[model samples]
Target: MEEKKSNGLAIASLVLGILSIVIFIFLSFIGLSWIGLILGIVGIVLSVMAKKKNPTGMATAGLVLSIIGTVLCAMALIACIACVGALGQTAETTRDILTTIY
Candidate 1:
């Protein structure tokens, strides 16, 4: 009887996908979205590799989760950058106003 070998890549992909989602949820606001985004990208690559190596439900799930995480992280990162830019403009405007008033 031949035994099926475990897919380590699939397992890693799943774990990384899950971690990416969790990190994005907890730290996205603090500009940690890049970390989650990187993790999600890596998970996506691993999942694709795993799928190519051995088709499995785990790999599919990992791909889905990684995609979701990557999207969320990207959105969060954009929002943070927008917010920073807005604040900077506001500060500069305030400084100008104060200088004119003085």
Candidate 2:
């Protein structure tokens, strides 16, 4: 009887995908979303290759999770940037108002 070997890339993709999501959820706000985003992208590429070589549940999960993590990380990063920009603008406006009143 021949046994089928599981794909390693698929496993790595799954782990990386999960890690990406965890990082996004826990550490995304501290300018660390890039790590998760990169991991997700790499996982996605690995998962696609793994699917072509040996399609499995792990590969599918990895692909889906990687996509989701990537999107969330991107969104978080954009939100953080926008928030910073807004804070800066608000600070400048407040300073201007205070200066004018004094």
Model 2, 1-102: lDDT tens digits are 111333788888899899999999999868799999999999999889888888889889989999999999888876432344544567676677668755
Error of 2 at 61 (Å): 0.6
Provide the lowest-lDDT 10-residue window in model 2: 79-88
Tell me how many clashing residue pairs each candidate has. 0, 0
TM-score between candidate 2 and the true structure: 0.70
Report the error of model 2 at residue 6, Å. 6.4
Q: Judge candidate 1 against the unseen true structure and give its global Cα lDDT, from 0 to 1.
A: 0.81
Off by over 4 Å in 2: 1-6, 79-102
**Best candidate, lDDT-wise?**
2
Name every residue pair that clashes in candidate 1: none
Per-candidate TM-score against the hidden true structure: 0.70, 0.70
lDDT of 2 at 84: 44
